[model samples]
Target: MEPQLSHHVEGAVATVVIRHPAKRNAMTAAMWRALPPLLEGFARDPGVRALVLTGEGGTFCAGADISTLQGSPAQAQTLAMAAEEALAAFPKPTLAAVRGHCVGGGAQLAAACDLRLAEEGALFGVTPARLGIVYPASSTRRLVSLVGPATAKYLLFTAELIDAARALGTGLVDEVLPEGELDKRVAELTRVLVSRSQLTQAAAKEFTDGRTDRDAHWAERADGNPDTVEGVAAFLERRQPRFTWSVAAPGSPSSSGSPSSSGSPSSSGSTSG
Candidate 1:
């Protein structure tokens, strides 16, 4: 069966599932191509404030479908890179909820997300070395940025699969939960994110992603935004802030599935695995 990307939205959280259970959720070329549009939809939907990426059948993703590689290597790589970049650039916060194997391209996709929450038994690796394939420099840099150069080398050079504990220790994953607790934890976290100020999250995301310089313009832009006012007022009142900022608008260009032009945080494209 062909692999697929399934999207489900409830309230402010969207869940993107990668399904290819026959091969432990290995991503097919078509699935890679499908990601950008699906992610675009979520980004434009003001109702969706956060996203959770995971794999079907208790496994995250094993990587690119190797069977398809012999047919169209270049196309496969190009599409995969495009999807990776889209995930990285998504304006809202993204979390990778990993359960089982997350290797090769799967590992790259997880690395692209803003945060990763893994099951204690989850396994992660970057296996291009084992396949005699060159890992992309951009991805390497991201890995280095996460785990530092020495640990990045240890993973890439050896192509060894690391357990979730080791992954967390190396900074590969942000959190590790017990076997059955991942979904609950992720859902709770996304809910918190959704209830917070979108304006503040968006600006913080841009700065942390290193896409914007700190300047007076940031302060200028926030001077009278409703979110800012509500946040401050709520703090003074000792009550939870009801943030209402959203990206959706009638006739907004984003609604048509075009890339947003609002200078929102965008993903840095992924390097081919």
Candidate 2:
């Protein structure tokens, strides 16, 4: 089957799955082209508080579908870079639930996400060196930020496949779980993320990504928001806070509701591309 990007929402969390079992979820050029718009849709949905990126058939992405590279390598790289940037810019907290091979372009995608969780026995590498292709600067910077210059150099220079344990030790993956437990743990973490304030997460994400100038607006934005009031009240009352202040989309009416209480996000849909 052709590789595709698929996503579904459960409650306030969205899962974007890479599906191409015939090639161990290797990404096709079409799949790369499809990601930015799909992620934009997710960003515009106020109810989507967090996102999880994974792959079907028990594998994450193996890398780019090399067969497509025979036609136009530059096009493939450009599309992949665009998708990586979109994932990095997504406002909500994003996690990559990695299993099996996450190498080459697959590794680039994982690096772009805020966090990575891998199952035991999973493998990771950046194989541009092996392919005699230069890695993109943005991806290299993100990798260096995550694992530091020394380790980043090692991975890029050697193009060696590292196991899940090594990935975690090198700070590439935030956590490593047994195969059967990966999904449950990812769901649990994402649920926690959904229950928190989107305003706080967005601000923190921006600041951590080196936009310290945005810190000035954080206090002003937090001052009148109901999320702070509810959070404080819930803390005093010794109960879970019901955060209702969903971030409004550009030019859209602001809506408020307890995401935890709601069965799911207001919008729930899936598409393959």
Candidate 3:
């Protein structure tokens, strides 16, 4: 059969599969070209609330399918960049269900997701430097913004293998599970996410997207909000930070006692910036 992107829906969650198992699920230029419209369809369809990205066989993604670029490097590069851009702009909350060998462009794919639920055996790296290619500026910035300068440089400079533990320590993967139970874990996460309100998810995503710049907006929210106050108060009280990041109308706080919840601070790096 001709290679194609596969998607199946179960309730409010949609699973998008990279179906070319013969290549260990390495992404093709065409597949990358198709993601934006696919994601846009999901975003506009009210029936879908969450999406999970994964591979069909035992692997996640190996990187770009170099074989596909034999005749068109320029086209391949353009397609890859647009894919990453679309993924970054995907409005709904996205999760990456990472399995074996999430390396190179695969790592970029996972990094594009809002959260990563990685299998224990999966590996991650940004391998453009090893291939004499420049990683996209936006992708590089996204990586740097997620793991900070030191860790991002360490990956890009070395192009070395990183395991689940290292990924967790460096804030790469959100959850890691044994190979046997990875699917179940992803399913559980999808179930929970499907129950959340779209407005809340979009707001949280927007607020996070705004933090990419070294600007005054991020500063004000992180430094001077009631959420920050309450979070700190809760921390001091030996209680959980009751993060109230809901989609209340502007100036109409969710609760009278808690004025506003500031955006999350610098340390908790999500998959996005």
Candidate 4:
């Protein structure tokens, strides 16, 4: 099949598959451009409560197809950065389910997610150094935030692949599952994410990303919200809380009692060369 980003929603979760198996699912320029708009659509869809990013078959992404870097490298970099930012800014929970190799731009995409689940033998690296390319400042900062300055420097300087165990020890991934267990673990976590409150999740995402101006906005959202009430009532009754509050679409009034549409934030025709 031609390289593309394909997605399907199942019971409040959207799973996006990166298909470029011949290249270990490397993202091409077209694939990078395709991601932002695809994520925006999911963000606006009220039915989507969480998203899982995974590669088709055994491998995750190997990175951007470096052969495409020959001409107009600036434009290609711009597209990749845009895609990464879109994923990072997505209000709902997002997770990367990784297997095989996840290096370079692949690592950037995985780091952009709120959580990452990797298979035991998966290998990860940040490879701009190998190509004499300077990584973007934002990407570097994000990397440093995830795995710390020392480990980030080690990866960036050496361009060496780290095993999943080391990646986990250094905080590069949230979970490292046994072979054949990645999908099951990802499903379990995503279901838990779907059952939670979007109000809390959205606010926490912004705060964690270093946005300090939204405290009042979130305060208003929490005041008299049905989610808070239901949570309390459910706890008292010894039952699971049914959180109904969804993010409101941009410029739409946020309602406290029911699920509402959310404000926003792919596909390739297929890279790692």
Top candidate (TM-score): 4
Provide the lDDT at 39 for model 4: 80
Candidate ordering by lDDT (highest first): 4, 2, 1, 3
**lDDT-better candidate, 1 vs 4:** 4
lDDT of 4 by residue, 1-273 (tens): 677888888888888889988788989998998887678767767788999999999889999987789998888889899999989988789999999999999999999999999999999999999998889999999999999999999999999999999999999999999999998999899899999999889889988988888789889888998899999999999999999887744442332212332443222222221
Clashing pairs in 1: 88-267, 89-266, 89-267
Q: Determine the backbone clash count of candidate 1.
A: 3
TM-score, one value per model: 0.89, 0.91, 0.76, 0.92
lDDT of 3 by residue, 1-273 (tens): 345577766776777887777788778877887776666655545566677888777788888888977888778877888777677666567899988888888888888889998888888888888778887888898898778889999999999989987898888888889878888988888877765544446556766866344344435445655556776798799975544433233542221122233331121111110
lDDT of 2 by residue, 98-145 (tens): 999999989999998999999999999999998889899989999999
State in Å the error of residue 172, model 3.
Answer: 0.8
Error of 1 at 253 (Å): 8.7
Whole-model lDDT for model 3 versus the true structure?
A: 0.72
Mark the regions of model 1 whose C-alpha exceeds 4 Å error after superposition. Answer: 214-217, 247-273
Give per-candidate clash totals. Answer: 3, 0, 2, 3
The CA lDDT of each predicted structure is 0.82, 0.84, 0.72, 0.86
lDDT of 1 at 227: 84
Question: Per-residue lDDT of 181-202 in model 1, one digit per residue for the tens?
Answer: 9989998899898999776776
